[model samples]
Target: MSEFDAIVVGAGPAGSSAAIRMANKKLNVLLVERADPPGSKNVSGGILWGNALAEIIPEWEKDIPLERLITHKGTTFLTKDSSISIDFRSTKFLENHSGYSVLRARMDNALANSARKAGAMVVTGVTVDRVAKEEGKVVGVEQDGEIITSDAVILAEGANPRVAIDSGLRKPIGDQDVAIGVKQIIRLPENTINERFNLKGSEGFAGEYVLSYLEGEAEAGGFLYTNKDTISIGAVISSSKLREDGQTHSYDIMESFVQHPHIAPLLEGGKLEEYSAHLVCEGGIDSVPRIYGDGYLIAGDAAGFSFSNGLMIQGMNYAITSGIAAADTVIEAKERGNFSSDSLASYERKLEDSYVLKDLKNFRNIDKVTWSRVTHRAIPKIAENLLYSMYHETGRPKKHLMQMILESSRDSGMSKSQLILESYRMMRRM
Candidate 1:
């Protein structure tokens, strides 16, 4: 008999959730993490959206170390000297509590501990070399020099899925299929944060910006999230765009972002406390690989469950959803006494039935629109010029909105046809 019924790789949200679920069902589970503490190696923009966590721990909000509740969300298009933004604030966000800003190191560690409390044998500081297999069926994981055997293996090893790739469950991700994100934790007094962000108590603001100031071929966006006594700010850029630009470094982009006139004032008195960088999967649904095979299933970034639809980026919720689905699939397989490829395929069906796969599939082409010049350059320039012309009154006659639109489109170097085409693309994709 196998030592454990299932071995979960990685202890981030997905692995921990899966381990917790299976353990709660009274299955023997081993949860492994390469990092000494579960969330030490993880990085994100600091917002966990949706109600997926409640499925794992019903009163998670009461227990998790959340930074702030996200009551406002904004997106801005930026030029060198101006910006156009759409800001939305809702009391309903506070009433229903759909999202929260979180520090990964603290939140993920607590989640892993929850798995332990649910009876999972949590092991940290252990690297899983690859999934151990015999007769082309995954049996467990290989760590150090030993084979820790189990009836099944679940890969939750974040974006750099070494074990999944090595096991031939998926091919190497292409440069176009991924993104690189760099984040900074800036410390400010709680009162200072509340004042600067116009927030009260634990209410927070989350903003994403379309970056148009980069000096190369790079396509990227910047984000800022309000935390308890700190701010989480970062940029996520297309990996292929970064390579093609060759001249821009990720740090340089970050420096430029922080110093922007519109951004600088909000963080004037903050001190940099931490900096981290990591790879993020942003290829939408097309880049996702087969999630399940014989006696094995992949969850979280390992299965490319992340989604970015230009306006917002979502991954954590999808990670939790996929994790729960993977565990449920295992539970069903166990009842049937079968850990075969066909049996594990139910995981995919479960995802399809949930918002995880449905949202990804519906917005599959959004990444293309986000990476287009219309989003990064043309739109920002047009908005800046139009708004500046309208508000920056001269003694001369003021033009009507339609005439201003025409002039702005021409000034932005986009013809009528190109503008119409781009608008169509956005409509179709979004």
Candidate 2:
């Protein structure tokens, strides 16, 4: 017999949620983490979108460590010296509580504690070398030359997915499927944050910027989120783009972002509190690996359950939902006394029925839409030039909308035909 009914690797949203659900169902569970504290290794800033957490812990908002509730959102098309933004603020977002700003360390630590309270054996500061297999089926995990046996194993090892790749559970993630995310926590006064961002009470703001201003052939985007007493600013750049440009690095892009005239004032009085960098998935559905097999399953970033649709980036909620679905599958499998691949295949069905896979499949081509030169460069420049023409004061008569648009399109270095074709493609894909 196995020692534990299920073993969950990593302690982020996915692993911790899996452990909690399994433990609550009275299945002996072991949740292992490489970092001493559950989320200590994670990059500091992110948004937890959706209300998936309420499914597992109904009163989570009353206790979970969230920085602030997002009540405002903005998206900017940015050039080197100009920008045009669409900003919206709604009380509905706060009342319904759709999203919150989170620091992973506090959030993950709280989740691990919840798992412990749910009666799972939570272990930290230990690295799982690989899943222990017998007869081509995973039976447990090996760590420090020792074997810990389990009836099933759930891999929630985040974006790196070393165990999944090493164990032949999935192919190695290619550069096209990955991006580098770098973030920093800048400490600011609470009232100052409130005043600068026009926030009230627990209301927070999230803004995304297209980083067309970066030098070289780099494709990247920037984000700035308002926390209670700090600001979270970061950029996600294509790994392959970074490799092509010998001069520009992720940090250099970050430096340029924070110093931008539009972004600098909000962070003027802030002091740097923390900095972190990590790998993120950008490949949508095509990059996802085999998620379930005999006596084993994968969830969260390990299974590539992340999505970006140019306007919004969502992962944590998908992670939470995927984690819960993984646990539920194991519960059903346990009832039938089967842990075979055929039994665990229910995991995929659950994801398909849920928004996790449905949304991914629906927007699978978003990567092509957002990563294209037209979306990142030509569009932003055209927007800036057209807006500049409209707003700039001159003694001469102002040009009409069509004239300005034609001039902007000509200056953008793309033909009208190319622009129209790309716009059609974007409309169809998005």
- Taking the tens digit of each residue's C-alpha lDDT, what string does model 1 give over 54-164? 887999998789999999999998788887899999999978988899999999999999999999999999999999999999999997769999988999998889999
Compute the lDDT of residue 337 as modeled in candidate 2: 88
Computed on alpha carbons, the lDDT of every model, listed in order, comes to 0.89, 0.89
TM-score of 1: 0.98
| CA displacement after TM-score superposition, residue 270 of candidate 1 (Å) | 1.1
Per-residue lDDT tens digits for candidate 2, residues 59-164, read 9988799999999999987788987899999978966887899999899999999999999999999999999999999999999779999989999999899988
lDDT of 2 at 253: 89
The all-Cα superposition gives candidate 2 an RMSD in Å to the true structure of: 1.1
Give the least accurate 10-residue stretch of model 2, judged by summed lDDT.
Answer: 306-315
Give per-model CA RMSD: 1.0, 1.1
Q: How accurate is candidate 2 locally (lDDT)?
A: 0.89
